[model samples]
Target chain A: CTSPCAAPFERRRPGFLTLGCRGVSTGARGDPHSEGKARRAGRIAVCGKACLAKEVFGETLNESRDPDRPPERYTSRYYLRFAFLEQAWDRLAEAGFHMVACHSGCAAALLGEPSDDRTWNSYIEYVFFRS
Target chain B: CTSPCAAPFERRRPGFLTLGCRGVSTGARGDPHSEGKARRAGRIAVCGKACLAKEVFGETLNESRDPDRPPERYTSRYYLRFAFLEQAWDRLAEAGFHMVACHSGCAAALLGEPSDDRTWNSYIEYVFFRS
Candidate 1:
């Protein structure tokens, strides 16, 4: 609708999303071929709490520039890298996805415990497929 | 509640499940401290079409016994292995998941095209967290 959400090749189904608040934008952003089609062809994004972010991109990245201990690098701040992102890309590739983009942002932890006073940095992914 | 569905830490809210057909058992399986407390304490599962499967585990596995040409190895059969799954585990780690399991099964392509004759082999992942 208003850049609230998007996915790779959502246009293939057209009506897969019906929510007025959240659905594929059928105008400019809706058209995956509008621009950057060559690189950003078909991208899918999945965003949730920090926990889900960790589940999708929270790993002691092999290519991480930071070198610390604690399995996943227990640093002072929350950070994630492309440690196993290739797996996600590989998985989406089967569905014809040629590219993916990962993003992390802060949001109210609606699913966290009541005693905790912190926001969750939701990890999101953009999956893309080509024509 | 039947074993048709399950998740990690769903019991934290007790009444989070309201469905009569697909919800937590709330009895034996509901307790995370069961006999497998030492090993199978926390687990989560995510299953969907083969396309989703390839997104999660599809990669030229570093541990794959089969070595081929394609970037992901254009094998003769539908297969996937752990490559970037660690990223998923890391993402969920923030949520307290300690382990993850991946599974693939065949199911009717409820979302595929009408002309396609093949069933979709859904890829599933079981995520676990320890108390």
Candidate 2:
């Protein structure tokens, strides 16, 4: 993941708002604790969309940023930050993982009219396989 | 999971709308394939709330149910069914899993006024540990 992707966690934002890709260690076929034997899988599952965050948060998202606070720890009650799909693709590509499958859609209840582009469609899930 | 909880998958709803609890098998500490060595973990992560689904889908949610379709397979374009938190608690308790921790809150952007209760808070995440 890139700097932007790690920014949320590095800053220790509230658990709910720190929407970022997480790596899950799936033990390899051999010894469980052997070094380099575990296959780490990165799942960007059901992450909030940047576009939707911007739409919903607007100016409050920017106002919450504080330069005085240490990067290692910070908290906010207002901002909701999430990465764009393009960023996820870029970071995974940088890490040499190829997209195995990707699915993007929103709930029927959140869908807007055919003529109306603004919708509440909020999340995207992606599965990437390491090459 | 109860009949209502299994109804969605039993009818083979569209992949996105099948917002039901799923059990993931985490290989047990010993043998990976041994009969009783695998522990199944049920995660009801980031599931849509029934209240929000009702608020959004309204009449369409009920209209999507069909009496003639076989229980094994069916699909719908209109329904966005999700279980209430109470239902999840009941199911997990019945399955012998105790609540390890649960945190429920909406995104700051989705939060309504202190006086306004009809907010767009859409989802809830729950974590349960098997005994």
Candidate 3:
């Protein structure tokens, strides 16, 4: 990885990003830590189209600044405070991520679609234990 | 496409469901609507574990019930209200999803790992536009 892309945790810019994470708790191959660790932490720069940004960060925007008129305010901007996953995943993988359990969109991003078809690309532990 | 599974935007459960969405907006083929319309919307049931659920729905739980004691209270629960994406993706695909943008976790799920390499299993539009 390069400068900013490499050190995703330290990389920050004045732009939009849509983020999320993934973790592999079982059957992972790379690092031992990743085998049982939560495997994500970081960010990604997005072009931030208005509607897209709004859709992505609408609720968070409301919670942070204006709970009353969040959607309207979010609509006013061209960016969003996305969930911190993309960057996290990148950084973890660079460091070494084992078998990541892709959560939410992260899971979908891995599995192609959310079905029981083995044809899917993503594979997460069907059973997770409480640690 | 199954009964309740096929009829998404309707399947509702009684507990935790972390939610999120993703859209392709490019290179998709199977369904015209999916190619353009946002590529995610639905819920998946997690076998809620306290620490996991807390990490997942901490913020949302706080925002909804107690901002001050959100994390603390979340720790009390064995599950969290997850984003509604897994169910949505499963429903959409059985219904027919084309090239999807697997936002957030959905993206990670599709992409194997979040690095710029061809070895990845997931593929999404790197460049999405204002629609």
Candidate 4:
């Protein structure tokens, strides 16, 4: 439809902006007409703590009709885009995560998967560096 | 004083948000107490083309007093953060650019320069792939 049917994202905080479909599936990934569960949690785990990164628009990940196996098998990725905090770059980098930005000002690099046909949300990878 | 004097940003387009001072200068880079040109244009060049990527709040880049040198020497970088366009991921990759994103979702990876101390703008590299 209209790329997740509407605004297709969440505005968590002042500078926090998540663009495109709610989860990875809603855009072209999860065609609304499909009859069953499309994908599972594109979750986030940092410092051994896991959190729900995807915004459930109409259906939550658990509300779907499939038994959960693992989030890794859920190939269709999701994105959570926001400005970084102090010490965030080094912290994320030290944990095997990568970042990019301009030279002098704040903000460097976008984060996520390598490359795919999907072209709405930003990229993300659930890499538990410390664990 | 309050990090670039105030709200420290410009809302160009409804989803297109530039979060931080007018240029890289107004922030911690160029404290208001300092009375001179701090940095030159941290501009943009894409597809062998360049455009006005910065917004001038009060003093335009040219309005400064210093004789201009190459923009590269003007470290204290600036940022422009927005969602990418269709075919952008592959196109960016083909241009020696790298991206990351979620697996099954539409959004994948961010783009820009490697890790640095700056924290407002998204990372960028003037890597001209074709040329």
Candidate 1 lDDT over residue span B64-131, tens digit each: 33233333222212232323444545544544434422222111111122332222111122323222
lDDT string for model 4 (B40-95, tens) is 12432222111111222122223122234232223223322222221222233332
Evaluated at residue A69, the lDDT of candidate 4 is 24
> Which of 1 and 2 is the better model by lDDT?
2
Write the candidate numbers in order of decreasing lDDT: 2, 3, 1, 4
Error of 2 at A107 (Å): 19
Instruction: Please tell me which predicted candidate would have the highest lDDT against the true structure.
Output: 2
Full-model lDDT for every candidate: 0.26, 0.31, 0.27, 0.24
Residue runs of model 4 more than 4 Å from their true location after superposition: A1-86, A99-102, A105-131, B1-45, B49-91, B94-125, B128-131
What C-alpha root-mean-square deviation, in Å, does candidate 2 show against the real structure? 21.7
Q: Model 1: DockQ against the native? A: 0.01
Better of 1 and 3 by TM-score: 3
lDDT of 2 by residue, A51-114 (tens): 2233323443442444243323433322323322333333433433344443322232223333
Better of 2 and 3 by lDDT: 2
lDDT of 4 by residue, A15-113 (tens): 111112111222333455644332322332121111212222122223232234232122122322332232333444443333322222221122222
User: How accurate locally is residue B101 in candidate 4, as Cα lDDT from 0 to 100?
Assistant: 26
Among the numbered candidates, top DockQ falls to 3
Chain B TM-scores across candidates: 0.25, 0.30, 0.20, 0.17
Question: Model 3: number of clashes?
Answer: 36
TM-score of chain B of 1: 0.25
Docking class of 2: incorrect
